[model samples]
Target: MKKKVAKFSVLPVVGASIFFYSFSTNKAQDINTALLEEFKTVNEELTFEVPYSPDAAVFDPQLRSYPALGKSYVAFKEALGFKESGGDYKVINEFGYMGKYQFGRGTLKLIGIRDTNLFLNSPDLQEAAFYANASRNKWILRKDIERFEDQVVNGIKITESGILAAAHLAGPGNVKKFLRSNGTNSFSDGFGTSIKHYFKKFEGFDTSFVVPDRKAKANSPSVI
Candidate 1:
């Protein structure tokens, strides 16, 4: 009886096993490194990307720029008159509000203008009437103007011009009410224009020149 022993090199088998293990580990590391590099490349691409607005239309300069109020009193009043009645000197609304500045007969009389047709037809007179009314409103609301100017009310800044403009829209009484009520008492005219809308629209214009005169007349030489 003969016993046979299997003769195989354990070193070769172990060496081959170790070699393959190291090779596979290095291959996996290279793969991970490649994947990481790819990920970093994608991230870098995203880093330079900017979020876009759905409505990114460019704003119009004509619409955004404030009218040149600092140029002249006529320019300022003309700009306001345009908003009031499209600068139409002969315009009289259904509410009996006459001319570009939209003055009622009572208001025109208060400013001492007896002739209705003259106020309506003459642009200069209409502009003068606006100055008179502005002065009157300014005088009436002087304390309120001094107290509320540069203060924020209901998320809108209260300017002197804003107050005067609101007064123009809803009269000094309603403007006072709206101011005292912290803008909760919104007043709209016969034409559906709101006091707050006027306040916002007329903000940031220089109205310091509008002096408070109790007897502000349309023909007043200082009415500017």
Candidate 2:
């Protein structure tokens, strides 16, 4: 059985007020705890497509962390309220997206994620989100490298992993197009620090939440 920790006595060091505002006492704690757990478990199960180590997962130095995702996790936890006895695990928004990853119906279609029931219920959706993010990164990386190659010709320092990470967080196409028009630059102010903080936090997650069998069905109108 998954250990339940309710009634947050401490503000978790992982996020800011906006990142956690929507979560209740119980739900916030659950999300914080589960995030670490899921990271551990997923790394072991999934095969990474590139140079990332399951053993030593680090954010590529150039990318920003997903702040919106951390906030969304908190909000989803509060909305789902998994320990509420009557609540379900699905995170359904008014737009009809479901699961902790908040799979919008449109995103689901674009990503080719079928089985709406499983996507909303199974822990699998979390992995699905990771994969989707990875795919996005791949596209972005290609563009960054081409730009970086030009910089290399100019005798500038460049690294592939750094570009890979940037592409992952900021859409690669956007960054590439930006570089083509603008020029090489670095993250401004505290953006780099914030992302690093969240990357470490996200990497350390473990997801052992006791997914209730009954909750693993198609989303109902209510959180029953």
Candidate 3:
């Protein structure tokens, strides 16, 4: 009898090929993943812009993306003035705070306004004062705004505009204390308005465009 010749079958070869393909694909993926992880960890201190959390975005959706202190910002502040003193530039609160934005004497001076009457009587002056004060406050709390914006503190989500508004309502010093204390150090104006109230009322507007300037003046052309 002739010796049986071995049958050549493709099945064993095909099985080995498939196994090698799968193993190669998995190994490639593992290598890519490791490279990506390394790239991300390359610089631990690298920072990036992040979206505001839902609760932190307190402005009306339409107002959320408005440029800082832009047209809509002007309108919002006008409405705020309306709420505060009926948009009456001449109205002085019982506490002696005057004008559309209800500024105090010290705050006016800080913004380079020496005449309370001019600050309250001139619409241009009032507008400039509002913008100047907002800028000054934004400067004072710049770091806090960066760190706390989009974060929840004392169950209230923080926003840049909200922080500025709070600083306006309470002094920047008070706002700092309140934020650092995580809402424990509550403050109310002589009018009895709380910092939290300002935070809530002024939430979700963009104040990031406001530059921090120690020399921010109400008479500055940019503010006016």
Worst window of 10 by summed lDDT in candidate 2: 206-215
Candidate 1 to native Cα RMSD, angstroms: 15.5
Top lDDT: which candidate number?
1
Global local distance difference test of model 2: 0.44
Clashing pairs in 3: 59-204
lDDT of 1 by residue, 11-91 (tens): 677889999999999999999999999999999888875678698778876776655556344555666788889978898
Candidates in descending lDDT order? 1, 3, 2
Question: What is the overall TM-score of model 1 with all chains considered together?
Answer: 0.65
Local distance difference test scores for all models: 0.82, 0.44, 0.80
Backbone clash total for model 3 is 1
TM accuracy, model 2: 0.31
The regions of model 2 sitting more than 4 angstroms off are 1-89, 93-98, 149-172, 183-224
lDDT of 2 by residue, 48-107 (tens): 668665686777889876555343334333322332212444767565646654445544
